[model samples]
Target: MEALQAVLKSNFRSFDRVAVIGGLVRDFAREGRTGFRSDVDLVIHDSKEEVALLAEKLRATPNRFGGYGYKSGPWKIDFWALETTWAKKHVPMQTLEDVLLGTFFDWDAVAYDLWERKLICHDDYLERLRTKTLEINLRPNPSPMGNLVRAIRRLVLWQLVPGERLMCFINEYLDEEALRYMQKKEEELFSYCVSSRWKTVEEAKFYLFQERGSDDLQLDLFQIKHQR
Candidate 1:
């Protein structure tokens, strides 16, 4: 970890709001699990080039992780030049406002904002991520028993949501502009499933069923569980 901080301080000109998030953050603080990787994340308030420069310097270092070609920066910058994407998904503003901001995550793997710490790098891009997230409609943390319920809701919404109707929505909705947000979320789903010891959603669904242990609930493709 010290090597990571040293590389960032040496390579990058300046940065802020550089706290880690995602599985790495959860692992260090909570007892959460994630797929094993030597890579250390530094979520900084900086540009892609800023991150890339750090990775280059780290590549020249002698550390074992570095020697073994372990990544020392954001995972995406290693790839070719591409257009960045962002999203304005509906998060419950009401819930986000109530969350105790500032580096908080739960055992359930839910993310909450750190509203107090603010910094700017790359023309305040991190600020934009934080502020824009405020507009996101956050939902409450789901209990162990809530998995099946939430899955059922998602399954139903897949049918009811407007964009779910067409593959053209893939091209239309997933325009170049939306790729960053889409890819970011897609990676998240991958990490969660891999780390949680669930091979598929069905396995998690069965676990949730055992938690609920209620005969009243019935599984069906079309049925919406506990309508919101």
Candidate 2:
């Protein structure tokens, strides 16, 4: 938090409405969580010129979604213009509230307002954190793998068991052909993150079923319980 605050003070004095959001915010608010190797995610309600200026200052290149990454010490900071966030751009979400609330995971559905020095949380976000539970707040996400990987991280590392909604989301995610094709270069579904957990899609299936204590879920190619 000190690091992030220092970053804003030095680099973004002129910018406004640049809030720190997602993993970092949740972890910081909860006083930290183990294995929390999350990159800093920020969204600014500023002009494209401001975003570009920040990119130039950070010597970073914006991705196709108009977000950029900057390496500061051991931390990699990812910055996106508020409108550039997936839910905002693709879902045509027109408000900051929409962007903030439209998240795949309950815990990451929060933002720390930099100027106002307050936290903006989505529904049941605080309660979920208190209970260490995993849930899907938004189902229309672009990356199903994003939700799954994060859920597994919580299950294995953070000890957060999935709720009914999250389990349903995971089940739906299982049917996504792209889940088997997990080689995409996306924000949450990094190659190392997935590869370190499971070498093959079948291995992932086995582990998930083993965790959830059920093999009723089926695939045309897999017997579900026999994936191992």
Candidate 3:
């Protein structure tokens, strides 16, 4: 966090709302770990121009995600703008909590407000993190396929067991249709799981079923469907 604070002090002090969000905060809260190989995601409630200006000030390279990336030692910092187009409305986020609420998983719904120099999170975020649980955000209606893939990857990467309630929710809410939807991204999802060190599709399936405990869930469900 010292490195982040230093970078903000030098380059982004003028911005009204700038905070470190997502994986970095989650890891920091859990293990006091920082500078993980994954990109450090930052959220700013400002115009595109302001985001660009800060990137320029920091000499950060722009990326296709409408964000800028900077290398601070081992950390790759990615800053994103908040007033993005959604449902034809330019919804601008006002606080760190608003940004946290928009994330996919409960553990990801945590942030360290640089401006206020404090941590903020959704209710139960810390507890869920402590328990190594994964949850889908229904309010934003995040892509079911993407969340499922991410949940699997996180379970492998974090060596986490699924929470009982989370498993119940998956069994009750995630149906065959949801599994079928993910088939379209099977290859992509497969690569993600393997890259996270699952080694084989069956290994990934084991962890997935560890929570689901459903005979209906099968490895073939994730296999890519070849066009006949």
Candidate 4:
């Protein structure tokens, strides 16, 4: 993972800030939140060419650590590239953000510590990015579990609706690995729900919650203004 991080830092020299968002970021950093399985989504604010150039540079690097590299999209408005296997698989959610989009639908409060994040570029840009970071926390509606349930319903609906578009959306945004795990968990939870395993929903809720502590960020310092 550090190798990928290194490539990103070296290639995108002008980025004001770079963050490993999506599942990889959450797994390595955020806890208590639900986990995901898929490619590492590195979200950075850079131009299309800058992002493409970074992907090109990284793709050139030999996979000493054994990982595939490729690119997708020149979506000018968003400016991101989806790196995945050169060929398609039965996999769902080809991009890193796909799995996260459903879960972390809320806006994120992206803070930058000059002393911490590997920020590049000029001081003025840094100040501007910092200001943007501090002003708002991106909140996505729907709980994490709610997002997962919604995704499953979509998958089921794809069968009933019988359309290529919904299939494509599922393929684009759902993580195959995570989806399988979720299916199994849902099965188990359903069995528990049917079996009257707990006295009430509230009683069962405690077991469903993930336990995590404050040191999860691995940041040098931070102040959580608010979190749901």
Question: Which one is best on lDDT?
Answer: 2
Worst 10 residues of 1 by lDDT: 79-88
lDDT of 3 by residue, 30-89 (tens): 777553435678888788888888788789897765678888776688887776412113
Sorted on lDDT, highest at the top, how do the candidates line up? 2, 3, 4, 1
Judged by whole-model lDDT over C-alpha atoms, candidate 1 comes out at: 0.31
Stretches of candidate 4 off by over 4 Å are: 1-5, 31-38, 59-103, 106-146, 149-228
Question: How displaced is residue 140 in candidate 2, in Å?
Answer: 1.9
Which lDDT tens digits does candidate 1 get at residues 129-198? Answer: 3331111122322231233223332323322221122212222333333334433443555332211333
Query: How much is 223 displaced in model 3, in angstroms?
Result: 25
Pairs of residues clashing in candidate 3: none
Clashes of each: 6, 0, 0, 7
Model 4 lDDT tens row, 1-228 = 345445455554466644454334333323323533335444444444566666566553323211224442321111243232111122243433232322222212122222246422223533433321111121233234444444443223211121233233334444544455555665665432111323443432332222323353222123222210
- Which has the greatest TM-score? 2
Off by over 4 Å in 1: 32-37, 46-204, 212-228
Models 1 onward score TM values of 0.31, 0.71, 0.65, 0.31
Least accurate stretch of 10 residues (summed lDDT) in model 2? 216-225
